[model samples]
Target: MVQPLSDERAPLEGVIEISTGALRGETRDGVARYLGVPYSAAPFGDRRFRLPAPVEPWEGVRDATAFGPTAPQSPYAGALGELLPTVAIPGDEILHVNIWAPSDAAGAPYPVMVWMHGGSLKHGSNALPGYDGATFARDGVVFVSVNYRLGAEGFSVLGGAPLNLGLHDQLAALRWVQAEIAAFGGDPRRVTVFGQSAGGATVAALAASPVAGEVMRQALVMSGPLEAKDPADAGRITALIARELGVEATRDAFAAVDPDRLVAAQAKVLAGSSPLGGGPAYAVAIDDDLVPVSPGDGLSAGASSNVPLVIGTTTEEYRLWLVPSGAVDRITRLHLAIGRRAAKISAAAVRRYRANRPGAKHGEVFGAILTDVLLRRSEYRAADARAAAGAPTWVYEFAWRSPVRELGAAHAVELGFVFDGLAGADSVALAGASAPQSLAAEMHGAWVAFATTGDPGWPKWSTERTVRVFGGAGGGATVVPAPRLDELQELGG
Candidate 1:
């Protein structure tokens, strides 16, 4: 599937036509790669808080090697910089897409995977290391990673600005795919949208959005579910944050301010955290026009129940965020503050977790319990809700521990593995030199399979059955975690 880069296959010299205008991209690794491909017009100036407008067609091919400047974002440090260069192109036109495809020049259709990066809606870009689409393209898929509004730019709920502008950016990208994918050797009819973390959450929103009907047919939401701040509550939080910015609590007034200044105010808000303790005060509002209401509710109500779904979480989904190197000893402290158990701590809930690892340390128990409570429970909730609505849904738990940090299958660890980009330092260190080759093959293959066909080679999950457990010796199985899910959800997580 790896086609040699050729003159004929490269984007027409200085004039490859995109939906908006002509673009010129550089060729690399036997693939014609296009960077900074605008999917939506600049969401700045007066357009700052409005729904994305169609980008004006340009007079000539625009260079797309460097990615556009990221939508006003604050760096969410994790190893992202080492994983991908934090090179920011100075521009307000940040909503863009990157494409990588084979180079045979033939005008044939290929499967497409539109990827959304995970950063809790605060920070991340499509132009990251582990996300490079060369491998997927080599594997015969047209790969696209997108940059939507992030943090305040994408998720801050301003009244005058379009709610869910990040989601709107995604829709714009999908519209571009429908209009111009054929030029990149992609099939408009066979598109699969996939994402992790907040990106996964966005995918969930898209699944439930009516506008998404003609945008994508299949979706894979990795490690994100339909649970979070209620849209109405989210709006209230944004208005409160806006008040902190000394701006009137109205969208029009907020939109009149500079995007960078608004972003800085948002950063201050995130830094301040919420006195109410709901994490940062930024995310898509239910916006009756764009998001209607709860995306999970919509999914369960049969709005997008027909869309094929592949959803899963890591075994220790929250371990990355919970048990940090400097924080193991802090578990007992948190437990004391939040109480060791949920509500009044009924005997049944205690028995559910305590009975399994009888001799485990308090910290271990807390970490495990926290992982189940916050992460896995939400994933199960989403899967169960969708399945109940008649949507074909697959659920999974990635239990492959990182060999390097011994981080016990923590958050974002499965990303490189699922993308088949585990040769890097963190991934190789955790997965080992060879790591679990079969696990990567199985997981990545399943992703590709889901993209190619609606089915991902697993039975659909339901209240009676769940499928896909990437755990055990080499870590790959398709089975139900019914008891674990029931136990975790019962804890009121």
Candidate 2:
């Protein structure tokens, strides 16, 4: 039998009662335990492939002790499971949200931060050890992490189904926060949406969305921005994959297959076909109603929110993707493809990239090229758009090198440090044996400050002002030359 939950957890909007559940936590100061509270009901059955329908109200307090099952994902079937624990639900209708906040009774609202996890829109889980919100809660912010549709379940395009259903799921979560966060000691008016990679790109899309603007107040994007695959391209990709499964492109055919079988088929199709790599399958699609247009197009057209923004990318970002493992060859091939796709790189810039690293091998250039093609140029462009849109923006580059062998400030490295929880399981790679307490303090404090106030204790990025070079000499910050920025700007242009 489910035990009765404490009433200390209040209902958001003064209408929905939020029940309490237990949480496991440990921060720099010490260890502390808390609870996971549900703001909405589990999405299931008829709601699959549609917007997150409102969860039916429950009469008695419900137990939110454990995290809800993760949205479904392709099972790579390996030690990856031990590394990343995903709570898999069988249905395509998977929308669940989890919140971790200080349990102590509060009379006032606290600042809110909603996190969107990243998996190239294919795989990610809110239950990852790295994403635990206890540290953020202990740090005095009401933290919420979300689970949206993933892989084909969320991204697949069908005429009747909601395009960009994943995005809609995010919007639903934000709406919940706006209506109910106050009951959990969170200030809805001061909410900030942030994410990494796909998550970051989602935030950028939200910034461009009129509906998301009404719900969100600010944003922090790490390594992403708005831009879904073209609809025709997405449809063609879906068709090709559907054909592989002996299923038609119609919704009825898709609905007939088990979610696991569908995911397995998707993984098979992705392995054999280089869709996004150019054969035609695309992960994100232009859902005009949800996304309207590509994020790049939206920014250029001045269709973005004017909220404060904080955007940053790590220094050795490429190195993360080109580890010494089996990734070297794949990295090289992807880089060659990037060189082919690059439409704006001047011959001079290409020469410069090569000349700067005269002793480097084709492998290194390939990795760097991929970084420039996918992350660097996109990031620079997003900053440019934010400045153009008249939003208060701050752009920083995390240049801190890692003590680890080759994962220098790798993907998701800054996460735990920024949350002030560099002691978590996934964070072990970042903190090292002798973790940089001071640097973590500086970084964490800046994020907390940003969540508290509109500013991050730094000058804002403007069209006139370009980039902030974090971890410069004298342990301070510096600005990049405008001409250099202009040169990078040409890539995105």
Candidate 3:
């Protein structure tokens, strides 16, 4: 447990010395904020599409009062973009971390929680307005959010470049935290790395990484896919994009393309892809050197089994993509038949879903199948495997429905509550203006509690598969034994 800070709050304006140099930070809302601080050197020029190089030592205190440049990427397009907002700050120095520390918790070693923002391995950054870390800092924790390489720049398996460059960037940031967070009054030993969607997948992989020992103390995966692709399968996306650019699939060839042009070609190649059906999309891949095995295989088979873990999903994840695009309204019965075969869903299982979800439309039912197939089942299997391995694991389900665009308890709907950003405009874009604050308090409090102590105020996953449910038809947070066990078993089998 973190010791309480003295009643006297530390002065807000201050300079903290990290390894590279001293950084001057600003104060606001009783929190000390150091924004856009480079944890690694800019990955450009000779270093483009390569492992992150160390940040060169600076001469004077770097101006860190505002957010730094974000990784190169385009905005989320069309209707989905409307709900999930993004920032595109241009620059070569894109490997940065934004930090918020409690001014009142000075001199005390507060637990640190580092955030990984999710963007499907393509979009997102530390500069998103709703991702402010002040709330965690206010609650007596030092919070840090990281930005890494994305899309081809980060994930592509190239001929002469490292695999998982984005993941490597994240590891570098964690190493930086281990070396520097102490000066910010943080306990590096109590670090908890947590994230949503792709970010969640990232932490899962990190937990199983052979190098995870000294850097991270805990792991949390929220609605993140746990599968890692085979190198050849993963490289196919890069090959397609390279073909789109009429260039060879190699580091030198990709490095020659303009960053903007590469992402544009990537978008065009993936325009027809969807969560349910599509060609290869960018994802974490299995590499003999780094991710020797997939996270699910690693976690279940004892990799990082000793690490405390919290993994879960929203009730209706597929709605995030399906509803916004009018696909739900357009789904036909024939489409359901084809999806069942493609996703390997048994006819009996489809019948069960139809019966259980009485009055549900064809698209809604099919969407549920895709959600189970793509997301929910992955978390379920990971939790079960962790249980068998005798690891401490907590499972949760975010069931809060959003009135906006009928995105009921969708993939990222719980983000507003988790970050306690109901009043923020970014939160409003996804969740309606009247989203509940009580749920936010309960969920956020549970997270703070988990980071402070290994437990999330819920029973550990075991024979019962207990889950902490947040905001469903049942208004308050509750824990249920083996929720949806039968349905999950059918999907898994």
Candidate 1 vs 3: which has more TM-score: 3
Worst 10 residues of 2 by lDDT: 25-34
- Candidate 1: stretches off by over 4 Å: 1-15, 77-87, 105-107, 236-240, 272-277, 333-347, 361-364, 373-375, 385-389, 425-434, 462-464, 477-483
Instruction: For candidate 1, write residues 74-177 as lDDT tens digits.
Output: 65444333332343556877888999887765635888999998777777788667687887887778989999887766776655666677888898898889
Best by lDDT: 3
Give me the runs in candidate 2 sitting further than 4 Å from their true place: 1-16, 19-41, 75-94, 105-107, 272-282, 329-338, 341-344, 403-405, 464-466, 471-493
TM-score of 3: 0.96
lDDT of 2 at 164: 77
lDDT score, candidate 3, position 192: 95
* Root mean square deviation (Cα) for candidate 3: 4.6
lDDT of 2 at 474: 36
**Per-candidate total of colliding backbone pairs:** 4, 5, 0
